[model samples]
Target: MIAIDDILEKIVSKEIEKKEALRFFEELPEKEKSYLVSKLKTHLSNNANSVENNFSEKKERTLKAVTELQLNEEHKGFIDQMAQKLEKNAPKSKENASECQTYFVDQRRTGGLKKALKRLQFHLTYSECDGAYLYDIDGNKYIDIASDNGVNLFGHQPDFIKEAISKRLDKGYPLVGYTEELSQATKLFSELTGHERVLFTQSGTEAVMWAVRIARAATQKKKIVIFEGAYHGLSDTVLAAKDQFGNSIAMGLGMIQEFADELIVLDYGNMEDLSIIEDRADEIAGVLVEPVQSRNPNNQPVEFLKEVRKLTLEKNILLIMDEMITGFRVSCSGVQGLWKIKGDLATYGKIPAGGMPSGMIAGLTKYMNYVDGGTFDYDDESMPSVKKALMAGTHTRNPIKLAATLAILTEIKKRSSTSENKTDESNSCFLQELNEKTRLMCEELNSFFKTKNVPLIIEYFSSLFRFKFLDDPNGVVKELVFVLMRINGVETSPSGNCFLTLAHSDKDIKSIIRVVKKSIDTLMKQNFFYISDSIEEDEIKEDIRSTISTIPDMRNDPEQESIKNDQMEKLRKLIISDLNNFQEKEVTI
Candidate 1:
């Protein structure tokens, strides 16, 4: 028996490629090969920039294409058939990707990008994806809503996208240095979005990096004004502006404090703060803002955007819009059109690449095109800091990915335009049902809270929604929300916010709602919350009405000091009691 370490050492040490290693492992027969390789030791770098570029793992739908509905008699029958198949041809773990999975698992355990899902659990696996479903290690299916976080917009292995890639493959090399496909794709993307020209980069962070460069080039300014609660990607220069809670990632080693020192941070949608920026417009190159704050709060009001536009125009500073998440999912017209604001440059990614690593910087000619030749081309290929600007890495213009990109944009428009962009038919027939289900679940909980007078923020936007357990993150309900969603086959990202994909059917939404209701009932029973088992709609309505009734009547109440104090005291006591109760039922999530 050739030892497993001997085999993997040969491979990792460059003694053999993956194909050669596979052949060598094939001769081992049984779990012997897998078990051996799993024990081999290795190390991965945690330095921020040393991490493999993952901008292309765009969000994707969270399920499988197996057409398995709520485990009824029909699915039960399919399970029996599957059981028979398994009995006849049980998969030998040694013959699978056990080695690769093990490597990532061990590496992620030490804090790498591909964090291990579980030591025993298969959170990391690779499989051929087709259509709306995602297949994992053991062929388990999940309905992806974070659309792989916005690529694969038209779905994985979509026929149109696949055919396009196939057609491209039939031709010669799809990418040959810097050429026309880049420009043509740019034109198509820009034409649709109402931008004059598009500058193609390979990831969202790259788009952000270039946006700063363009602003610098046009204004001859050294500083950029970024929002406090924004994420333009993990580029070195952008690290100063932390994410929602302010954990400074992208600060591993290469990112010096001086680099972040150049970026001026401002609050999101603070119109008056523009005066601070306005007083320093000569020094400030541009104001970068996300149209909708995705993930953290995942909510940006339209009025907030209008104020941003007004302030930027008044200050005569460049306004760079980061629309990475809102481009495709928010509306067919993208963020600017959805919110009625204009931007000099719109940083795009997520869905535009069809689940591929890609990014685009779209802007007008006067400012965007300035950096091409007439300005600083300070060696992106030569200098380390600048190298990122020039490097698209391998497969930047992969024919397969391009084909998928073209298909996704076309399909999204077709579905949206024909039905007038998420019409009653689509919503009532599909998304609305899911949205209502979620809304109802939250409504039920909030009603109970209102009766208890517990303050909560049950945020919702269209079919995408998640209740932030801010009142008490230590509570059991926060953890149950994740566990129940997974058990019910409605898996969402751990990041609190969720986006509903077209792959999720109305029936599936109902199932999710059923699971949520049951989960809520469970949590209540566990005293995770103090909601009653027999919560009635009338009681809920009355609670809502009473809450509304306390709105202070600003028109009549010139002296509302007593009301404010009373409300504050009520809130304070409720919070104290809730936290005490939470301590008894909390799970250390």
Candidate 2:
């Protein structure tokens, strides 16, 4: 017999399973069982509060570090230099920069590093995009590794997609109503995803939001289970994270705290988390998964996904595969096809419309019936039967979008037919060739990093790859690397993520590797990897402001010239002192 105190301690420490603890409680006398239940509730409540407090403390520390890094002199100077170079190379982009700065609120372009970039008045205004390249207004070309955030599976403005859009425009480009294009596109998507029903939305976020609603209506359950670090769009219901105690916490402000009440956040790729779903099976409406998280592509939990599929089926809960990033990029059928694990419902965007904005929700008919009222025959006077859920959008099935989608699906079908049995090693088909090229590029880059002993590594899942730091304690080195890459004429996602398109060539791949090598070497020479811990934040900020004011373009203000001169003199003294310190260190060595 286990002592009550022992069981309570193990439960608090998570050493014993909840089920085991319950079994032990069941064996106790009635009075003891009641006492244990009360104690257990209290312990769990205190544990939750402790977890929340820890998260708050860690968040505070991170914000402080970010503030300090932002004020670092070297970081500011590098960004200013990068901005000046970009402005010189792309004069027209500079001329038109205000149009975007004044009207557009693009967080992706200016979020975390906004203050530095904004002060420098930096922006990238594209004039045209062709195969494997983006041309700025001033005619400077950059290899398009960003690929419009993975929407351009075949690169920018592919001829096939362009032709499809042109054909639709010539046909008057109906803004509303169904067409044969919609029917064919739906049929193709249904066949590709192996889902019986298909519904279109204007964006991936809408698709996910509706999928959750449909699941709730169909299952009559309120709770949704999503994994940590998995992005399922910006919907209020799905934008949440698991605190240390497994309680739901909204990821951002403006989200109602109660919106996360029915959400159960779980640890991605953890087998033990499956038991939690089982424990709360009766209340769960669905399990939403992103097979490869766009932010953290290294996590490809195949076996765990298989187990989720099995568990959801056994428990009669819906499984929603959010393939907004992985869909049509990894394979013709997305992760479900690649991993051979099926979800009851799947959401797709990005590549599905071939660069056109569209979203699709495909699922088994039983659950999808909630979206529409199931099939009804007009001649038989049969009315819609099943319960309905609200799902409507102005651009849900735009004719032009459907035409482009049909064209893309047709192309994918042709490529997939030939590549069905081919592995990543085979270059027999276009998709396989692209995948192989990406794999080889990543392998070569990883090998170079290893040989150079650079504290950076690349992780990829198919054509999607991201740069990760091995030791960036302050988390500022990655941002520096991104700026360096841009200065070297390579564009990447703000998070240092890259998506290789089918349009990228062997030469382009080599150029990318060269740019990465150059960027890393520059960072190493500047000693960016070894940030000094002793520098005071106020001193750093003052030094950077002084340096920035000394730049030739910033000399327009005559009144501040005297102050600038004094700051420059101080900066000169500091530089000489640094050199003297370096000399002393060398003599000591």
Candidate 3:
């Protein structure tokens, strides 16, 4: 086997560029390369786990080595190549049924499994993903718009994250209990969320369950107030919804009937509806909200949230913000920092785990103390009986998850601390650019639909967007549109929820607009969307002109910018005034 340390030392001593060293390393036989990587990882881990007295010394040396070995463009390109090679050998899908059948029972709703196969004329059995793309079993490639429900922040197979996790694995995975990684993750969570205390869980649902229990225990109240269409979790208590008359009702078939009595479901975004909380303030434990409602993202009224804060404060009710989907997606501090409304407690998951499965319950010390241990003064007769909140699981403090979380938090803080004058190459600036590109994509989609006199529109909440159809006269046109999107090499959920990640470039966004336009045209040819009047040769050309207008000059070239602007004006005329020219021509799809 090759001496990994010798190679590393040579790279650090500037005898060879990091890129060239990596190239040499990649050219080795697979078994040898894997052996060399494992050895290096083990060497790093042993040094990392040294005695406390020598820890700083070891860390300084390790950091120096890592700085020299840091990945550059060539290294990332090599990693992507390796990822693709691995995907090339992925096992074939089962013959009789889709792979989703083995994992979930309801295949129809789970990312268009059976429907995509039968309707879209193809199936996508993914082998691996890297950054913005998914590679399937048959070697087909597709750009992922869904982002596995928005879990990937920097995208799949990020080199820095992979290295960090590999280093932790070399130290040995602590599946049974806590480790220094767990402590580090806790400290990072506290610093990032501004929460005084924290608890870990295996999934978002567990975090929500813990938050509700903590809220109830801390306030000594039995009933909780929740908003309609707010998905806190699958827990019995949080599964209730507000009916037409604003009464709490269990949403699921087998949900506990009595759970409704423990909840007060109110219409979200309706300030007047919150008045009911005033009457029940004495009995209410807390109010659970999504900050930006998942169902209605376009209407995140700041006034409503401020009123929520004021009402909760005046009535002495706790506020629990569920940032499961909105946590890192919205901002580094989640919605609390974005909207500047701090809550008594917040539940986070999704991107908080760095594409892994982990959840967090964070809150004030007074509230979190109910879950953590402490012996009260039993001798004090005035003390009320404290109902301890149960919030532990076998996977609560798994070291692997903690390491991934630490990596994510470290990157987040590092990116956020960059100077304001830095260019877009910085991660924070790139995130801002990503969000802007997403907003522009949404705007372009809506404009294309309206210009062609289609009934569809796209709406967004931060980087998350969903498609909306004004009228699906064919009863299945919406599903057909989704199927068309899949055939066009983009994956999205059936509910039309799409997400944008930091991995997505301006080129990716442009491709999305072009793919969507192609999908719309395909659906029209298949007689999908009901176009009242169309079918002129000039109309088709006009549609192309409209799409071309949406493509911006992201290359920073002045000539290209001017050309794009002129095209935008032509598109405006074609869609706005010239659209009248097609009103008289009758065309049916």
Candidate 4:
């Protein structure tokens, strides 16, 4: 087999240009090419971002204080504009104010609200999203990157899984315990992933919890190993070691430090970090990891992952891969499908069960026997329920979401069916195209932005890209995000990273890149080139303050941000509102 380095080294050393290099890659065995592509991309990863001023103490104060303010007219205009773009894949349902009475409180009831409404001319109202699109009360649409946070993969209400769940609804939700739906769902999950069993849970975090408990129970180990700068759901234990600011080292506040003692924070990409606990591997029940850290948009290089697989095996440590984000996005089956990885225990959610709010923990047959089959020699059925009690939650194999998930996965399977080893040409060439497109876009975006002398970084992996909002203390990236939000008919966002969803066509992506290009051009013309490698902190502060000042202050006019104060008063009683709706915030899905 030809190695990836054999190909990339040739490309890097100018033995061949990229086009010829790609042709060489195309002619190689499928596995060889996949390996080579990964190698080639990594070989190009240089620190493309230039350092910018950090947030100042005063700006931090402003952000913290923003919680008390209200949205102004310009802010409202911006919000309305952004809302339209967010509807790219939303279900086309007319949103009548009367229809959403169940979810949002009417803002006309209170005397203060009525008086306030009399005071303002317009209102800005938002609705909760379902999958790929967002709907507004007043006939506006948005492409929903917001809702995919953890569970928007199936493209919403897909017909495949919906029919399966709808049939269940017709059957009266079925009997609750050990039912056929549970069995079939688990069956599909285990079969697809090569796991022996599945324990269904409600959410990704809940599944994370169960995976940890079962690991402790099976190995009788008090400790677990995790990676730094990784988020493993928001469970108390998992949230403990978070790095809030980007030092690569993360620490969490609410988690008890004592738990931190039991948890080993292995610097990502280090296998020796595992050796520190080598003698303690048996004392370690499992190692939990995100195939690719969702927070950092950077991939776990091939070597790091290969080492992880090796160390876990060498130390006899059970591998618990947390696939909540990477499950359906990276490959049709999952990230493990992309790599030759099989975990002893794995967690699934995000696109499985279609898009319905669902989760499950899967384990290999040998390791899962304790949680399955009979306990006390079949004399007690109580043990099975113990697992059930931990796993079950307001379960919705929702017909609509499940249907969407099925469609999404089926398409993924179809796209990925071609194995490099097989003689069949029906391979995941389409996805490879998408991956190539992403790489090109990342490279082009980086080069274009750099040419403008903008010291920003746009990093992409698979279909997702994280735009490193330049180190500009003036919040240029935030401004660009706001511009994307405000642009008509373009629902690009600075959040949820970026999406290369099924609904997003080549044209839609081109529009994004176009806007990004324009924005970079504008920023380059305006951004001051640094005088030397050193930046002027005072100038950064002044720019930030002055830029923020230009936005009309919304603090004095709460009623104007939404419906009139009258409507807002009524709405306030029902809906939770954000005080800092204009503030730049980063969200992970």
Q: Tell me the whole-model lDDT of each prediction, alpha carbons only.
A: 0.52, 0.71, 0.64, 0.51
Summarize candidate 4's per-residue lDDT along 1-589 as a digit string, tens digits. Answer: 2234444444443333334544564466433432343333222222112232322222322111010012346444544443454433222321333345558685332211111121121222446444355555545665543335535444445455566667656666432444455544555556556677767666778888888877777677777778765677767665433111111111233345566556765567765565655756767778888778776666466677767778778876788888877775665446676776767888878766565666668877656655554233457545442232123355534334344444545555555564454522223345566567667777887777555555456766666666664333122233444344434334444233565555555665666677777655543333322323222332433333333234332222345545233432332222111112211221000
Query: Evaluated with TM-score, which candidate comes out highest?
Result: 2
- Candidate 3 local lDDT, 202-316, one digit each (tens): 9999898888888888888988888765777678878864422234555545666588768987767777867778877998999999988765566587888889889998987
Question: What's the lDDT for candidate 2?
Answer: 0.71
Deviation from native of the Cα of residue 285 in model 3, angstroms: 0.6
lDDT of 1 by residue, 1-589 (tens): 2245345434433333445554555565333332322222111111111112211121121111111111246434433443344333324322353565545455322221111112212133436565555665555565555456545545566676677667767775546565344555666676567788776677889889988887777777877877755788878777663321111223333456577667776667666666667677778888888777764444475786677677677766789988887675555446677566879898888777776677878878777656454234466653222212233446656655566566666665455454543432331232234446556655665555334332233555544565544323322234444544444444555445566555556565556556655655543444434322222322332343344345443211337647544654453344234323433443100
lDDT winner between candidates 2 and 3: 2
After best superposition, candidate 2 residue 559: deviation in angstroms?
66
Among all candidates shown, the one with the greatest lDDT: 2
Give candidate 3 regions above 4 Å deviation. Answer: 1-96, 99-123, 374-387, 421-430, 473-475, 531-589
lDDT of 2 at 170: 88
Clashing pairs in 3: none
By lDDT rank, best first, the candidates go: 2, 3, 1, 4
Give candidate 2 regions above 4 Å deviation.
1-81, 114-121, 419-429, 531-589
* TM-score of model number 2: 0.76
